[model samples]
Structure formats: structure tokens, C-alpha cells
Target: MSNGVIVRRGRYYWHLSVQALYDGKTACIDWRSLLPLNGGTTKQRQSLLASSKGLLIALVESPRDHRGERLAHSTVLNWVHDLRRLIRWMTSKDVWSFSDLRVTDIVDYMTFSTMRKDGGGEVAPHTLYMRGKLLHEMWEVRHQYPSPLLIDSTHWILKRRDDGDAVRRGGHLTSQLLFPCSVPR
Candidate 1:
């Protein structure tokens, strides 16, 4: 099943739509229009549409029951912008779908974002980490429910880290670090 959004040719404007079949009924999504094919790069426009589709799916699978309806129009538009940026970044690295992501992919994306930029500054590690976390969260929600295909382990480790541990060991648990003044009086 092609989960990514598909480009549809419309009469007046190119309609970006995603068709999800649930219980033998089709859920059709028609996102707001793109500039009449005149202003943006073809790749940019297509990525924009695809990202919109991804967000629609994300909203449905969002932790919040009514994320889509709760967001204001301008906020929704801004989300589209953020989604487009994410898609473009992913596209540059040949990551076009959520399935393309892996543990290594998360590390690589963080590295890419944190590298010194042409503009002379690197993005903060915290920023890169935040983006990775958000993307991972989206992947988590999307896979929690059943899909057309049986979800594999990539989807199962949603709450767990790359390893199976609920709490990462080898921290300062055994140390007197928290009670600093208690050391060797």
C-alpha cells in the first residue's frame, strides 16, 4: 500500500489528495491549493503536497483526539509550512516516507542538522534532537493501530528505545551525586 500522498490532476488546479480506505469506505483528503504551477520548483511543490498528506494522516493518528479541528487556520497553514520543510530535508537525503527512517537514520539526520551551516553557524544539538523526537513520535502514533500491512518490529519499539530497556541503566543511580553534601564528612 502506497501510504504517501499521491498527486491528482484537477480541472482548474492540481489537487493534492490522500485516499485511505477504512472499512470499505474511502477517506478523501483535498488539501488547500498550490500556486498555479507558476512560482515554485516542481520538486518543492510536490513535496509540499506530499507533506500535507502526511500531516493529514498524522492528525488522524495524533495523540490528541482532535488535533486537526483544534488547530486554527493559520496554525494549520504554519504546520503545512513546517511539514514542507521536514519533507524537503528528508528528500535531500532520499527519505521520502516514514518507513525510510531507522535508528541510524535518526542519528544521521541529527548529524546533518547539527553540522556547521553554509551560513556559518550550526543548529543546536537540542534543536536537532527535538526534531528527531517529533518525527519519532509521529512514527509511533502512525503504527500503534493496525494498518493495511502487518507492522513489524520497527513499529513495535515505539515506547522502547533502540534497546529493550524501559529505563537506561548505568546512570548515576548508585552514586551519591544528588546528595552532594553527604560525601565523606
Candidate 2:
């Protein structure tokens, strides 16, 4: 089948295709419609869009899980959502390329994700944990991305503090050392 063509198996179409059958009707999700890519400059936007597409496609093609099972289509879609948020945040911080990201930026992103959208309160602990875990998964597959993150995300830690708040350590910090409580907002 062609790149954008929907692959059908009886009434259902493959979820990885650009189009799928829903309720016996065709539903299209064009490749260009995937990422918002709204906040960056033209060059940055192009680069990000290309890189993001490459990463998603790579993940779809490879079973990087420990059990070597293909990721569920919903999981890949959730990663797309997470990537959109991360890309927007990175653009705001003048980080166009994943390779340009630093450990401090990663820490800042972790902190930024904890807040409620309406400024009411922090997000649920599980929500924060899931987001962090997703990020770790992406980091593990960084090399598969066309533009990979250079920072060693494995060195950093995402753990709950004694007070039950999420804590992120810098890549340079060891498990015995804690980041100072005053992480810049």
C-alpha cells in the first residue's frame, strides 16, 4: 500500500495508517496534521516536525519494549501528545533541537508539568509519575530519533521527596545527593 493509504482488514483498518475505518466510515489523520508545530520559527518548526515524525515512525517500526512487543496504537498516540507538550515547552525555552537540551531544561520541564492548568493545584502524583516514565522511555529510544537528545537522562532521577512532592535530580547528581529544594520555577 502507498504511504497514506489505509490498510483494511475486514471492517477495521490498521491503526498505524494515516487513515482508518471508524464505524464503517473513513477517518483520516494526515501526516502533516500530526504535530502542532506552532510556536517555533520556520526553520525550527520544519526541523521539529521532521524530527518528530521520524521518531514516531521509528517507534512504530520497532518493538523497543523489554518484552519486544509492539506498542499499542493508543500508547503511540499518547506519546505524540506528550511530544507536543514537550516541543511547545522547548520552543518557549529557545530549544529547537533535542540535542540542544540540557539536564536543567529537563528538570524545569518536570517541574512545569506538575502544576494544574487553571492554577488550582498540582496534578495527581500518578499523572506526574506517568509523564516522567514516558519521558524516560523516549530517552531510552533517543538514538532512534532523527534528532536525538544528547543528555544522559539515565543519570537523572525522578523520585518522590520525603514530603511527597516530585523531585528531579540533575544528571550530575548521584543517588545519595539531593537537588536543593529551591528549583527555579
Candidate 3:
């Protein structure tokens, strides 16, 4: 199927099935299949969920970045996962809109995520990098959404060191050492 979000049963469920740019196979996603929203009133939670779903729809429909190149299917899936994390974090803090998100909140989230335990350890460095990149891309595609993120995320730059470590600065995870083997030089 072409890249787009499909709403079914009067908005109770949404689905997306698109051709993967990397492999040219159908990639199917069921929107209602994600984890349930937590830590907010029903109305607030639903509003945020709706907005996020809209963002996902917009992203899938237009997969091109600033360079007019298509994004890989895996990249889009990663964004979907990252967006869920972002939404959960936002709702936890009572932040309902992207416009309401502050840089410090983002910083706090980055710190919180680093400390988040998965399989008895902190999240991987490459995972953090991907999350940071998602924030940048969210800003890049803000104009495509109905309610857009107002903050400028261009300053959140990711750079590779002389070693095979990826680091972000200027409003992102600052100086958080990444595993050398996880990132490419």
C-alpha cells in the first residue's frame, strides 16, 4: 500500500501499511496496538494521543527529509517507537502539547532515559542517539503537522568524535559518553 494512515471504525483504530523504501515490502502498523497512554486524565491523554497519531500519519505520507530523500522503513519504525516514548514522558509530566514542551523538560527526559533500566542496564548509546535524532526530525517536519512543535531543535547537533562515539550537544544529552563500539566513526 501507499504510505498513509488509515482510520477505521470511527477513529477508534488507525492503521498504516506502506512499502518499505529499503526493501520494497509491505510494512504494516496497527496504531491501536501500542501501549496504552499513562499518567493523564482521559481527555488530556486522548488529545495527546490524537495529536501524535496525526503526526505519525503526516510523517508516513511524506517520508522525504530536507534533502528530498526517502526515509528508510526502519527509520520510520524507530520514530514511531521514539514518539511513543516522548508521549509517555510528556504525559507523565502533564505536558499535553509539543508546543508546551520546554528544552529543560527534554533535557530531563534525556537524563531520565539514560538511567532507565532495560535488562538490568541503562539504555544503549545508539538508542539515545536515535531518540535525539527523532527530536530533530520532529522539528524538521513540524510544519507538516496541524499542531507543530514550536521549539527549534536544529541546535541539538549530533557529532561523531575521533573515536567511534556519537555525542550530542547544545540542548541535548551533553557529554554523555556513548559506547565506542556502538557508533561508527
Candidate 4:
């Protein structure tokens, strides 16, 4: 608990927040620990828990989200697809493992998702938003809670062709458009 390290629970997961001081520069890092590994000998459980990859794989296969509802067919499929993509991305980046995944690696994954020769470009903003939501559902080794990765990735966005110009995002997504203003424009 010392050195500015704090562990706490969110809606369902355990969060480890640590502040690091290096070269007189300070930075904070947060990690979402996975769900507890059960149904094995102490040593076997420990071994599975020790490997972040294994932990992640278990999380992906979990039958339900943190809320305990049975995972929908599409949800499981998305998890499979995304997890595979993540593993491939990890290998391509030569990442040490899942536990060692850094925020930079996450950012890089976002970067990689946007490039392709076919109809693919970047993952849609809504898709990224949904993925962020799902991150909360999976990968809880503690209390089965939300992951900070979801919150962190919410800001992820790719540069659009009109980005340089101040073209506003469409207003249709907001409910304000549903009602007419009292004052005439």
C-alpha cells in the first residue's frame, strides 16, 4: 500500500494503481487483474494465475459477463475474434505476455486496427466504444468487475480526412435534436 500503490474494486474488478517515480519524472499506471482461477490444486491454480496469457484465455472463455447473465452468442464470438486479434497483435509486437501489456501496446493495437489494403481502415468509433464496454465484462480475476482498459480506450480515435477542418460530428447521436428549441434560430 505504500509508494502510492492502491488496490480497490470497481463495479466488478480489482484495480491496481501505482505511481512510479523514475529519473525525477513521475507516472501512474493502472492494471485490471483477472478473475480468480478456481477448480485446481493450489499450485496448479497458482501456475495458471501466474501466466497473464492463460488468465486472459480463461477470461475470454468465461460463460457469463460480470453481471452473471449468460453470454450471448454474438458476444462470445466477438470475444473469440478480438482475443485472437489481440494475441496476434501481441506476437507481432513481441510483447512479453498479457500481464506485461502496456498502455502503449494498447495504443499500438488501436493504431494497427486502422490500416489495411481492403475495405478495412480503422475500427469504428462505436466499435471501439463497444470493445471498451466488453473489456469491463471480461478479465476479472478478483470481483468480476469493469476493466480500466475500457475507460482508457474510450478516447481512442483515428484521424479522419476532415479532421483538420472543424466539421462537427453529426448531431443525430444526441437526444437534443429530438426536441425543437423554444427560441427560433
- Which lDDT value does model 1 have at 64? 49
**Per-residue lDDT of model 2, residues 1-185, tens digit only:** 22323244222123443324333554333444433546667887678767776666555655554643434445656666677678778877878887788777878787888886689898776566656766666677787787777665533446533332323332221121124455433
lDDT of 3 by residue, 106-153 (tens): 666766666554546677666766777667767877877656677654
Model 3 off-target regions past 4 Å?
1-12, 18-38, 63-73, 157-185
Q: Kindly indicate the candidate among 1 and 3 with the higher TM-score.
A: 3
Residue-by-residue lDDT tens digits, candidate 4, 5-72: 22442333333332232234422221122322223355533332345333343453455434543333
TM-score, each model?
0.41, 0.65, 0.65, 0.40
- Which stretches of model 2 miss by more than 4 angstroms? 1-39, 64-70, 160-185
- Model 3: lDDT of residue 47: 67
Cand. 3 Cα-lDDT: 0.60
| Residue-wise C-alpha lDDT for candidate 1, range 88-107, written one tens digit per residue | 56556665454555555544
Error of 2 at 139 (Å): 2.2
